[model samples]
Target: MSGLRVIPTWRHGREWLYVCGEDGGTVAWYDREADRVSLLDEARGGDALEALRPFLVGSVAVGPPPVPTPAELAGLALHPDDDLAPNRPGEHLAVALDRDPGPPRRLRADPRRRALAAQQRVGEVLDGLEAAGWRVLHAVPLPGGTYVHHLVIGPGGLYALHTVPARGRRVRVADPFVTIGRAEPQPLLRRARADASRCSYALTAEVHPALVLVTPSSAVPPAPHLFTDTTLPTLARTGGHLKPADVEALHMLARDRGTWTRA
Candidate 1:
């Protein structure tokens, strides 16, 4: 928000919406009531509304989660470019809400102790990303689906994870978000080799840049819109702050102090 114009408004309901733009490049909307913000930009992402916390804007204003509203889902734009490769570009509606959640949740439903096959599939991608100098912070299952994995690539590389299930019988999870359609391969414009998986193939057209290769399964649904724009690099994004206590303790130890005690 320092130089960006993020539009925050309300629809005809209990929801609040927000969208962003810089120098009026494009108009986006954030609707808290509908749990989503629409950007007039080119890229599309699901769960888009969750990122609009006041903190992200460097705003010290503390408040409650806004409500959802009834707006023209098709008119609200959330991106600046229309050529959001790897994802369908245009104004679309998602279940973006002001649903304040706890945190990155880990749900273990089955006691059978099954591992995520996507791990293997994603491992290849992570290896590629890391080999290409992308530091992965963490990976998690998307809320609306399973085949999709959310890999937190440092400072700003938060991308939608994907993989085609290896001829598996079933999806371990209930509802994994997904969207399946023919896509054209996009060239490696970023200075990388062009490759493709069995299910997720890279062609000339970049359909969903957010796409990833995951083991196919019924645990998730096909989510067509899931993306976000990031400023921080993968390494910087995953970097955490130093602990004050730890730093202080180290100082005392350096001075030949045994243990710390309060006077």
Candidate 2:
């Protein structure tokens, strides 16, 4: 793999420098230190990769652009399911023009869309955490077609967070489960617990499972519920004795596509 290229992106909270191959849909991401790389797919893998190169190798540096607000991202024509094509100016124009080319389409209330929306909702929360020394990853697809919404690390600790759609509803956790307007908590709690366990085993750390509910008119108790406007003081309480190095390690492991995707 002599001509492999990658683009640097920041999403959910962490920086991802990855390559979406020209043909294979294979992905590989570099660690923060740039000393290591992990491939997401092995079916089209190679052991003799050359020195990695940035997608914008010769781009001229201009003044830094202003930070984008959530509104801007909302208006942008992008989504988690969109393909990350190779770096070429007009490469995507054909695909874009071939698309519906009309107003964006709204998806039905299906499991996949729910998961994607939950990931987006949690992304808004992670955006605020950057200043607080937090790092997060979103939409991590695991085995069996399941997705982990947000994996967060900060001064408080490591968390496997899931955003539950509970708009206009008051949600409460009654030990080992959550309750939202007559909805049973066991299913949600069980899934969250299993996801946390999987994340913990993957990162070799004790990951805590938490819920992020979307409610505009209710005050979430200062517990596992992480509202977009409130501080999750309890979530990243003390880093769980995790140091910066540990956090980076976990981030790299979680970012590795192979960690979640099976060969």
lDDT of 1 by residue, 1-263 (tens): 23444444322113343444453343345544344444444342222334455524332222332342222322232232321111111101011112332244547432111223334434434544433323331222112232223332322322333333323343322122333223233322221111112112211112122443234333333333221112112323232432333322222221111111110
Q: Tell me how far the alpha carbon of residue 19 in candidate 1 is from the true structure, in angstroms, after superposition.
A: 46
lDDT of each: 0.29, 0.55
TM-score of candidate 2 relative to the true fold: 0.57
Residue 172, model 2: lDDT of 74
Give residue 178's lDDT in candidate 1 (0 to 100): 30
The per-prediction tally of clashing pairs is 88, 4
Error of 2 at 93 (Å): 24
RMSD of each: 21.0, 11.5
For model 2, the local distance difference test gives 0.55
Q: Compared with the true structure, what per-residue lDDT tens digits does model 2 show for residues 9-124?
A: 66334455555554434345554443445554444235213334432233322222235454322312232234221112222222344563444564544444444454555566
